[model samples]
Every structure is written in structure tokens, then in C-alpha cells.
Target chain A: MKVVDIYRAIADSTRRTILDELCEQNDQTLFEICARLTNNHGLGLSRQAVSQHLETLESAGLVKSRKEGRFKFHQIDSTPLDEITARWPADASRSSPDASRTTKRASTETEEQS
Target chain B: MKINWTSIFVTDQQKALDFYTDKLGFVLKHDIDMGGPRWLTVVSSEEPDGVEIVLEPNSHPAVVPFTEALVADGIPMNQFAVDDVEAEYERLSSLGVTFTQEPTTMGPITTAVLDDTVGNLIQLVHQDEGAQG
Candidate 1:
């Protein structure tokens, strides 16, 4: 398994947008991704530039590409981000109603595991 | 002078003819045998006299690799205008056609990319009324 540095992968705004698009709909070809960025986001980037961004995301394990028939499609894999949430205790964050429920749920899950 | 004809390199003319006519609903405009390859062409049923799409053969040494690279990158060699991209996507998909990119809307234009099954990717585009380019 490849170790993913989630921070580095998401450092670029374009890469983050790519992840957001993939999250909205998994499995998009490179051309589709480029079109979305240009049409939806108004980011008129060249295909080669977007391809390099995908490479960086792939290296971080934040993105995966699969060959289907004659074309290739890209997908998002955010599992590498688990390390971030795991390293920092969620309960320690500022008080929010959602956070309180999450803390309680986390404790409940821990109790159940024990 | 008006642009009357455009060519697309096809891996096989017979397959291209069937796919263009039967699958895409294009009308065969010309099919003259040119010894080794045919001077094949098809036009949109909606505008039979608009522009003829020449289904040229990809016999040249550089043509195969060029088309392959473009297909691999999901780039369309040619694009056709349609009234509704989503409808066409649904119709073509039901006919066992493979799409590299599903119908996606951006601003006033919606587009989809599909494999022509003859060594090229073709785009079907639908632009909202009054939308330029």
C-alpha cells in the first residue's frame, strides 16, 4: 500500500476542485474533468496541466485511474484522509452541536469495541 | 468557398458505415470504391446537404498511433450538433454504444463523448438557444 500525504495532495486549489468533482460523480475521463473545470469553474486550464495535477493527486493516493475499454477514467479515494482525523481527537475541537453528537457517537463506538 | 466535406480516419470503412448510418442515424451521401479504399461519406439526416463526413481509411503509418493517442486521452476527433445531448446519450447507450464522457452541462452548452467504433471519439453537443460558441 502506498502512503498518502493528504496535505500535499490537497494543497492546490485545482486539485481540491478535482476531488470535489470526482466526489460528486465518480469515474470521469480526463476530458470530462477538463471540461468541468473550464465550464463549471471557469478555470480554463490546458489538458497537460490538468493531467499533471491528476498525477500529483494519484501519487498521494487521493485519486485512482482505471482503464475501461478504450478510455481511462479517474476516481477519488479519500481514505488517506483518515490519518488526519485519527491523529487529532475530534472531541477536542470547538463546541458545535454536530461535534457534540459526533463525540458522543465516537465514545459509544469505543465502548462497543471494548 | 463553402466548407462542404470533412474527413475522419476510420479503422474500417464497412464498420464505420454501419455505425454511422444504423447507429448514429446518418444518411449515406456517397460510397464510391477507390480501388483499395472507398470515398465514403455520410451526412446528418436533419441536414443531408449540410456537410459530408468522409469516413477515410486510416492506412497511413502515422494515422493509427495518432488516433489511438487521441482516443486514449478521451479527445473527440469530430463533433456534431444535436438538439438534446441527454436524450441522445440515453438513446445511444441503450444501443450498446460506449461513452467516454456522459452528458455534462456547462454554462449554456451540454456535451457528451462516445466511441465511434472506428478509431475515433465523437462529441455530441447541444447548445442552449442564443448561446454563442
Candidate 2:
């Protein structure tokens, strides 16, 4: 996952709270999320504040919002990133060998040419 | 600007916390519960206030599988550069940090692989000066 995407999704404090709420129970309307954050988490945030954070998280693919009747519901959408990072193994010597491995041919060639 | 660390969901958040700070000597940054699953972040003492690792709970279907695959493959989610991989490995071993791969040298680089309990394969590597031959 892009650092920017993760950072953008998590930069806001309210959005993190919203994501935690969704984890407990997903696909909740704006009012449900706001009530939980206000009453339970002690965020005491307004509904508009929660919506603004949801908008940013939706843009970053961290959360998805759906329109249901007059309500806009939001849920965590964490499927986009899989195997976000992979790197080649770092090893020099494979076995316990007595002699060092080197490009003998290259050294010999350069010597002969010189 | 400091990187806001990383947030990865784990099946067991407490285990992840112990594996990071207790075993690996990372400083505990945050241990707050937003609402549901507990939230935690650990920062390496080597780079305090730099970049930390957030221990998020693995509840989402996709995140759970993604973490499982990485663990099954024994692929470290990330590698950390260290001044001494062997010494760090030894220290962590004393703290009961089980290493999947022992310290092995490759040319001028040495590395050790260990499990972070959060379904992550973490590597500690030491690169000598001018190893790119």
C-alpha cells in the first residue's frame, strides 16, 4: 500500500475512531456512527465532523460509504491491499565453504588485456 | 515530517504488543481503544519519535487472510536495519523471541529472521560499508 494512502486514511483522529466503530459493527449509517463515537468513545464530535472524516477515508479506500434511502452508511473496505510489501532475501554466503568465490575469469581477462 | 508508523490488523493484539516492545525493545507509543478492537503502536527505541508500528486487530476478512499468507510463507512483512543483527538477535532470543532463520551472512550483509506475533515476518540486517561489489 502506498504510504500516502495509509497516512491519508489515518491522519485524522476522528476517522480512526470511526474505523474502530465499524470494526465492531460495519455498514452503519452516519447517525449510528456519530452516536457511538459521541456516547461511547467520548469523542463528543458532531455528525458533520464524522462525515467529513468518512469522506477522506472513502477517498483513500480505507472505508466505503453506501447510500441507503435517506442515510449514507459506511463500512471498512480493507481488501484493496494484499502483500503490500515484498523484498528479496539478503544473503551472501550460502554454505560453510573454505574458499571464497570470485570472478577469476574477469580478473584474468583484465590482466591479459593490460 | 514523521511517518505515522503503520497500522496492521492482528488476530491477537496483546501478543503483538508483547512481541514488539517487551521482546524487541520497542517503546510503547499508544495503547488506546478507539471504540471496538484495542489500538496500539510501538516505536523502536533506536529511532524514537521516528516511525512506529501500530498493532491493529485482524478482524476484517481480507486483512486476516493477508496476514495469514505472509505468516504461512515465513515472509517477513518488513526488514529492519540494525547496527548489529547478531547481537540484536541474541538479545531478543534471551527475551524468548523465536527466530525462524538464524543469523546468516551473505557477502557483506548478515541477517536474522524472527516472528513478531502479529503474523509478520520481520528481518534484522547488518550491511557493511561498500558491500555492493
Superposed Cα deviation of residue A10, candidate 1 (Å): 0.4
Off by over 4 Å in 1: A1-4, A94-114, B129-133
> How many clashes would you count in candidate 1?
0
Chain A only, candidate 2, TM-score: 0.64
- Give a tens-digit lDDT track for model 1, residues B1-133: 9999999999999999999999999999999988889999999999988899999999999999999888888989789999999999999999999988888888989999999999999999999889987
Q: In candidate 2, what are the lDDT values of residues B1-133, reduced to their tens digit?
A: 7667777566688888877777877888888978877678888897887787878777777886776655543446677889889899888888787665567564477776777766666778889677774
Best candidate according to lDDT: 1
Evaluate candidate 2 by giving its C-alpha RMSD to the native, one decimal.
23.1
Per-residue lDDT of B22 in model 2? 74
lDDT of each: 0.91, 0.70
